[model samples]
Target: MMQFCYDDLDQWCHHCVHFVFVDEGLIAFSSFVLHLCAIKA
Candidate 1:
């Protein structure tokens, strides 16, 4: 039971990290697109 709990916690942590990484990538892409638009304008 303890091992199962630890595994669950590890999986949750991995998911959280993956989400944050994806979120950061999206924000960076958005900023890059805006920068391009500003330059075009």
Candidate 2:
């Protein structure tokens, strides 16, 4: 489950940066996921 979420995040980050003009929020979101998963672990 954890690895799946991280993989999804990686794909989403690339897609988000590629498609969206606003990356700051996406980057922040990714970081949030990192912290979230770390805490979960």
Candidate 3:
């Protein structure tokens, strides 16, 4: 997983319109998608 700066997360949240910080650390959507793709492959 990648580490994002606060500003990067802020920008994403602004553009995403609906975002929440979950305690489980499952917030990195792009990485999560890539991980899933890798798993499928």
Which candidate model has the greater lDDT, 1 or 2?
2
Candidate numbers, best lDDT first, in rank order: 2, 1, 3
lDDT by candidate, in order shown: 0.44, 0.50, 0.43
> How high is each candidate's TM-score?
0.39, 0.39, 0.33
Task: Mark the regions of model 3 whose C-alpha exceeds 4 Å error after superposition.
Answer: 1-27
Summing lDDT over every window of 10 consecutive residues in candidate 2, give the lowest-scoring window.
Answer: 12-21
Candidate 2 lDDT (Cα, 0 to 1)? 0.50
The residue-by-residue lDDT of candidate 1 on 9-41, one tens digit each, is 343343322332356656665455445445655
Top-lDDT structure, candidate number: 2
**Tens-digit lDDT track of model 2 for 1-41:** 23443466554444433332346657666676656555655
Model 2: lDDT of residue 7? 61
Please state the error at residue 13 of candidate 2 in Å.
13
In Å, residue 20's CA in model 1 sits off its true spot by 14
